[model samples]
Structure formats: structure tokens, C-alpha cells
Target: MLDLRLAPMAGVSNLPFRLVARECGAGLLTSEEVDARALVQGNAGTRAMLRHLPAERPLAMQLLGSEPEVLAEAARILEAEGADGVDLNMGCPVPKIVAKGHGAALMRDPLGAARALRAMRKAVGVPLTIKIRGGWDERTLNAVAIARLAEDEGVSAITVHPRTRSQQYTGRAPWEVIASVVDAVAIPVIGNGDVGSHADAAAMRTATGCAAVMIGRAALGRPWIFATDAPEREARAAIVRRHCDLIQGHLPERIALVQLKKHLAWYSTGLPGAALARPRLFQARNASEVKAVFWGLW
Candidate 1:
């Protein structure tokens, strides 16, 4: 079977969403980005990102930060808490994140990224991985260079998004960048970006020789993308209900309400009048209200 994994999306790939994706056939789940400094400082919110049910096992937690020492300590905490692996985030293009010298900013300083990876690699016993962009920008397309550097530093695997930070999430993802990284690295390379269906996953592997495919934005509200075939409306409804149940059961009331509104809105994507109904979904004051608005549309 093709290895289809859920990309670690900030604020979206929470426990409930990951469970839904895994149930839909996603492999090797990853958690939302955890802040290395905040995690090491024992921030309650940062620690919450590490929470996982046993069923989500074999999961890796991705860390966001630029400091080697802070990241090393954070990786240690994740390993001690039972993470299957630790992933360094190097592809986030958010302006605030980049301004902090984290995320894709690290791509500009290969030596700094290597040092951080080296520190984290020695800090944890579990597999160490990284998700990187093609480069800092078009002028510096150095994914292959970074992949080779990661392999030399004992990184277990690499995921290439193949878009320069300058491109952010816009424009066509230059998959040839992925192919270049694959040809340049002996370690496994996972391809991400612009893959929305099983067909796209297969095409990525065929085009890039990637060992796996990570689905990001495309999986939003449509976890069934990981399933071998798209489920019927009745089945999709069941999945959506199950997802609602999971969110309610696993998260606090306040957070559950937000997630319920967010995901249920995504679930409403293709239904007639969905565009107009979206406002009501967000206006829902509680889970029951949210469900009422959504199922009314369903």
C-alpha cells in the first residue's frame, strides 16, 4: 500500500482530526507544531500539543524553534513522554515564525539547522526527522543540500515541501525540487505539497521517487482522502459524526466548541447552500448549537 501520512498542521491537526485521518487510512500521524522553548518551560498549552491517545501511536511530534539547546531539551521531553519520534519544523512560512528565526528561516542558515538537528538527535533515542522547504527563496533552492546535511547528521527521514518560503502556499509546487532531493539523498524522502487524493499521492511517488506522501491542507474537513475510495454521503456523515464525538469526548468544552465549528464547517464544504450556512456554523454558541446548524444543512 502507498504510505499516506497526515502533515502536522498548526491549529488543525489536533488529536480528534488525527484520529479521524488514521481511521481513514493515514499512516504515521504527526502532531501540531510544539514550541521548543515553551515546551521546555512547561507551558500548559505547549504541553497540551503532546497529548495523544494510544491508538495514535507511532506518532511523531514536530517542534518549532531555532535554538539548538532549547530544541534538544524539548526533544528529550517528547521522548521521555513516549513520542515515537521527533520532527523539526523547517518549512513554516508564517511571517511571525520566520521573523523569529524559526521555521523556514532556518533553511537560510544550513549550519544552524544542522547544529540544532545534531543536538536533538543526541537528545532523543527515537527517530529524528525534519520537514523543510525547497529553500529560503528562489535564489537559494538548497533542499538537496539540506537533505544531504540532515542524513550526515543522523536524521532518520526528510520531508520536502518543494516550495520556496517565498512562494509560501501559493503557486504550483515545483515537484522537480522533490525529485532533486530524492536523487541527492540516500535517506528516505517524504514528499508533501499539492497532494489532494490517492491519485496525487501515487503521482508524487512516481514523479519524485518519494518513500511516502504527507497530506496537508487537502485533508482538511475531508479525512476520507486517505481512504482507498471516497465514501458515500451516508458513510461520510457517519465519519463527521464520529469526528464530532471524538472532539467532544477528548477536548475541553471551550476548545471542543471551536474545533466542532471549524471542522464541521469544513465538513459542510460540498453541500448545497454551504457557503451561506458557514456563518451560522461559526455563530453557534455551543456544541449542540453547532451540530444543530450543521446537521440541518446535512
Candidate 2:
């Protein structure tokens, strides 16, 4: 089956959000990128990111780093921590990561990327996957080449976000490039980029023949996008309340309230009085205030 999976977003895809996405029917869930070096060094904040609920099984822990040794060590750590699988992040385009020869920078060195994959594959018994961009830029588009290298090094699957590092998240993702990578690899090629609705998911599959579709920014406040049934107003309010409760359970009250503000705003998206209500929603300082924002909308 071509299942919909959640894309790993740095600050957004926390345990609370992942739980919501799972309840809404996501097939697979990936943790936000955890720095391999930080994990190996035992950074508490980074280690905290590894905490997952038992329900979020079939989870893939994503690690970001350029060194094969450090990545391999981090994979071992994740395996020890009960991660179901591991994903190497080679697609991040942030300047700091790129400057350090990590993320999209690896596309410039296919051999090094392959070496890292091989080491991680050998170190862990769990399935290993790689997520990558088309290339550093249009002139160096090498996703197909890298997909082949990943398969050769024993990668279990590959995800292609069909935009170059230079393109970042701007412009339309080149679905044709994803199709090219799919044709070039025998392993499952997961297509990511520009998927916002069920129709977009279907169109991406039809156009690229990808094994699955991964939803990123689109899944933001609309976790129900993965569900089979469209939730009505009352149901939507209940879901929002549950989401706020989950956030409270997972984080401190104050921090949770701060986080809830954005989610409150997101849930208001497309609502009749969203524009009029946003100012008060953003001004909310507690869960009660946040709930009142939604309740007011009703």
C-alpha cells in the first residue's frame, strides 16, 4: 500500500504532534532530526528528543551528521534506546549544516555519503534509510546517482525531496526529478515535497510511482488530513483540546502554553473568524486562555 508518512520537522514534530498524527492515520512517523554528534556526546536536550511513546512504533529516528563514525555510534545508541529504524538526514539546506559538510553538502561528495551509509548499515540491525535533496543546485542534480549509491551500500529505502539545496523550500518541487530517481532505483523511493492534500498525494503517486508519500508542512495544524473521516466542528474542537492536553503532559505548563499558541493559530486557519481571533489567540498565556480562543470560535 502507498501509505502517507509524516516528515521530520525540527521544532514541530515533537511527541505530542506525532501522537496526533498517528491517531489521525499516518502510516509511519519520523522523529525530528537529532544531531548525531550531540547524541554521542550525551547532550541532555538532544537525548530528550529520543523519548518516544510505545504507541509511536515503527518510528524512524533521524540523525544529522557528516562523519561516518559518529553516525554509526548514534545509530547504535538509537538501537539501544528501542528505535524501530534509523534515517540519515542528507537533505537539510541550512547554512551551518552545509558549511560543515553535512546535509546537502554530502551530495557534493557521493563517495563519502556512501561510506557513511555503509558504516551505519553495518552497525545496526534495524532498517536504515536516507533522505536527500535533488542536489546542491540544478547544475549538480545528482539524486539518481546518490540513490544508486545508497542502494549499493545496502540502504533499506530512499526519500527524494525533488528540490535542490539552492531552491530550499521555495518554488515548486520538481516532481519529474522524483520520477527520475524512482525509475533509477529498485528500492522504495518515497516522494516528498509539495503534498498538501489527499489529491496532491494521489497526483504525486500517479506522476512518480513512488512507494509512498511523505507530508511535511501540510500536516501542521491539520493532522486529520491523514484520517479517513472528515471531522465536524465539535469533533475538531475536541481534537484541539486533546492536543493541548498532550502538550501539557509532555512539557512544562508554561512552555506547553507557549507551544499551544502556535497550534491554536494553526487550528484557526481557514475558520470563519480566524483573522479577527488571531490577535487574542497569540496573546494567550495559559491553556485555559488558549481553549477559550477555540471556544470563542465556536
Candidate 3:
């Protein structure tokens, strides 16, 4: 079966959002990228990022770092915490991450990436995966090389975003690169980047011969994209309320309210009277206020 997995976004794929995505039919929900070093250091915030509901099972926790030992230790921790799988983040293009020789910088050193993967694979007994870009830049489009390396190191799957680090989220993702990866590696290859609708998802699968399609930014507020039928306004408002309730259940009230604001903004996009509702939604001080904005929208 073709899997529809949620991408491990930085701040957006928190527990609340993953639950919502799962409810809407996502096959797999990935937690936001957690720092291996911070997790090993016992950072409360980092540890909190790993919290998951039993209902969100078949979950994958993404870990970001350049150190083999630290990543191994972190993968063990996640395995002990009941994560179904672990993913190494080699696609992030943030400057700080690259400066630390993590994320996409690992793409520049296939040997180091393989070492990290081997260490983590040895430490955990779960399915190990990797999310990577085409490469560091246009000059070094080495996803095929990295994918083959990952396969040799016992990786269970590979996700190719098909955009170079320099391209970030801009420019069209070259599906041809993803096709090359699919041809190079025997394990499951997941094609990601610019997948906004069902058609786009189908197109990516057909074009790349990938095993699955991973949705990232497109799923920000529109979790129902996983479903076959779009919900009506009343249903949409209900989903928004359910999302807020989930957030409140998982986070402290103040923090939940703040986090809900961003989701509310995303939910409001392209709706009727969105221009007027968005400002009020952003100015909301609490969950009640956020609910009011949704109520007013319908």
C-alpha cells in the first residue's frame, strides 16, 4: 500500500498536530525534529517534544545531530520510550544546523552520515529511516549516493525531498532526482516536497515510483487533505475546535493558546472573510478567544 506520512516539521508537527493528522487519515505521523544532544542532556523542552499519545502509534521520531554517539544514545532513548521508528534528519537547511555539521551538512560527508546511521542502527531495534535533500547545493546533488549508503548501513527507508539545500523550499522540486533515488535504492523511497493536494501526491508517486508521499507545509492547517472528501464549513470549524482541544489537553493553557494562534491563522487562510478574521485570530489571548474567531468565521 502507498503510505501517506506526515513530514517531521520543526515547530508544526507537535503532538497535537500529529493527532489531528492521524485523525484525518495520515498513515504515519512523525514528531518534529528533536536535537539528539539536547535530548541526551535531559533538556525538559527537548524531552517534552517526545511526548506521544498511545493513539498516535506507528509514530516516527526524528533526531537531528552530527555526533554518532549522541545520536545512538538518543535513538536508544526513543526506542525505550516506545517510538515505532526513528529517523535521521539530513535535509534541514537551516544555517545554525549546517554550521554545527548537522542536517544537510551531513550530505557533504556521506562517510560520516553512514557512520552515524550505523551507530544508531546498532543502538536501536526499530525501523531506521532518513530524510534528506538532493544535496548541499546544485553543485553536489548526491542524494543517490547517500540513499545507496543508507541502504548498505541497514536503513529501512529513505525520503528524498529532491531540492538542494540552497533551494530551501523555493523552486520546483526536481522529481527526476527522486526517480534516480528510487532506481538506486531497493528499500522504500518516499518522495517529498511541494505535495499540496491529492493530485500532487499521485503525480509524485507516478513520477518517482516511490513507495510513499510525505506531506509537509501543505498540511499546516489542512489535515483533511489526507481524507478523500473536503469537509464543509461546519465540519471545518468542528475540526478546528477539536484541534484546539487536543492542544489544550497536551500543553499548558497559556502555551496552548499561543500555539493555537498559529494553527488558527493557517486554518483561516483562503476562507471567506479570512482577511477580517485573521487579525482577530492572531490577537486572541486564550483558547476561548480562538474559538470565538472560528465561530465567527462560520
Candidate 4:
């Protein structure tokens, strides 16, 4: 009944990657959080990071900035470029963003983060959301406070990763805390933490009373996660073949070969010879060599 949202990992959630995840079972996929300042400068790499296949729809673009107005301007810039929706990344713990007083650093300044959310909501007519962590540390766990602010500002949704900033993606997320925030806010609450399986997806919804569950890390190389029926041998073969072909569809010959190798690991994970293939895949730098390894093994 609830949808599964894909967590945006930089260098990992590119357009080709999203397409693969979509085919697997992801209900909504977000692009890797883009740097607003870099995009404004017309950086080529930044531009490329924004690429999305036409099928990877209902895409949400996340912008990172600390200042309320600056973040608002960035949200407007993305909305005008035809983003289906926009998300503000208030939970990123990267020191670089924190150094600029952004990302999870916002947890230390809820008032400021709230004002930024208000400004961005005022600026955009599209669905606007906030992805937040519990707080800066155990001593400052204030996800409930942040959720309240998001609701007051009229945000379309709020996603809580449920770990303190100090926890930084380690340890289990505090699932019980999600109920407090859910009770406090009127918008959709996307619960994210250690959901790696469809069972986890169903459980997260029940555990937190969240409207949806979001997944990261677990999804790598495992599109079958969304459709887990212990795929048959023939189906497995077909999926691997199709995933490889999908990579080849969008990427150039050389790039596809190299990139598909990584995907091969994702597809092959937990399979009989998957561990043997990971190193071989990463070491592979071309398509023909990758095909040789895969086809030779297959």
C-alpha cells in the first residue's frame, strides 16, 4: 500500500542507475543531491549529474544550501527547469556542507532551517519536501521539532532518516522516534534507515505509521529486491541480460562497458559467483572485457 522511495546517493544514483532501480520496484526515485552553486556556474560535471532518462519520472531534485534565501533561489532555479518536485537536503552529514553551515548542520539551527523551508515553499508551486536527520547528536535529537517546522511551513512531505547526525548512517535508526514526528506533523513522513528488503519496507510503514518507506545501500545490484519471489533460473538470466542491455542503452560503448561492470556486481550480489565477479568487474575498464567475463561465466 505504501510506496518505496529511493535514497539519493551521489556517484551512485545517476540516471542509468535510477532506471535500473525503477525496473526493480522503486516507487519514487530522487537524483543525487546537486550542488546549487556549482550548477549556477554551469559546471559540466554538475550538468551531467542532473541527467535523467525520460522514463525515470516523478523525479525529485535535492539542493544543498544553508542560507534561507540562497536555498530558495536554488529551489526556484530547479523548479523552472521542469523538476517534477524539489527536496531540500537538511540531513547530509558531509563535512563540506556542514563547513558551509548547510546539510545536517541545519539540525543545529532549526529556526534557520525552518525559515529556509518557508522561503522555498513560497518560491515554488511544485511539491516541496525536506529530508532530515534526528538531530546533530543524541543530546540534540530534535527531529520532532524539525517536523513541526516543516508542517508549519506547509511542506508537502517530510522524510526522517532517524539517526542523530553523530550516528551518520551507522547503527539502526531510532524507529520509535518516527511515531513522535509522525504524530506531530500533518504531511507524509518517509521513514528511512535500514530498510533493505520488501519485508523491511512493509515493517517500516507499520512501525512508524509512516506513509512510505525509503531505501538506500540495500538496493545496490539488487533490483530483484522489489519483486522478491526467489526468481527462477531463467528469469534471473533474463534480468541480468536485460540490466546489462539497459546500461548499454544509455551509455557510450566504452563508458557502458566499464559502468555495466559495477552494475554486474549489483545484479550478481549474493549469487553463486558474485563475490568472484566484484573485483573482476571493478578491474574491468571496457565493455568487451566485461562481456567476456559475464558471457564467459554465464
Backbone clash pairs for candidate 4 read 221-266
Where does model 1 exceed 4 Å of error? none
lDDT of 2: 0.90
C-alpha positional error of residue 90 in candidate 2 after TM-score superposition, expressed in Å: 0.8
Q: Is candidate 1 or candidate 3 better by TM-score?
A: 1
lDDT per residue (tens digit) for residues 4-118 in model 4: 8778887677777787777766777888888877776777777666667678888888888877777777788777776788998889998777989888999899888888888
CA-lDDT, candidates in order: 0.94, 0.90, 0.91, 0.80
Supply candidate 3's per-residue lDDT for 173: 93
Error of 4 at 2 (Å): 3.2
TM-score of each: 0.99, 0.96, 0.97, 0.90
RMSD of 2: 1.4
Comparing 1 and 2 on lDDT, the stronger one: 1
| Candidate with maximal lDDT | 1
- Superposed by TM-score, candidate 2 places the C-alpha of residue 34 at a distance from the truth, in angstroms, of 0.4
In model 4, where do residues sit more than 4 Å from their true spots? 228-230, 251-258, 295-298
Question: Residue-pair clashes per candidate, as listed?
Answer: 0, 0, 0, 1
Give one digit per residue, the lDDT tens place, for model 2 in 1-298.
4499999999888889898899889987999999999999999989999989999998999999989999999999999998899999999999999999888999889989988999899999999999999999989999999999999999989999989999999999999989999999899999999999888999999999999999998988889888777788677777787888899899767778877988878888888898898989988877888879867876
Clashes of 4: 1
Per-residue alpha-carbon lDDT of candidate 3 for residues 37-106, written as tens digits (9 for 90 to 100): 9999999989999999998999999999989999999999999998999999999999999999999999
TM-score of candidate 1 versus the correct structure, residues matched by position: 0.99
The C-alpha RMSD of each candidate to the native structure, in angstroms, is 0.7, 1.4, 1.2, 2.2
Please report the candidate that would top TM-score against the real structure. Answer: 1
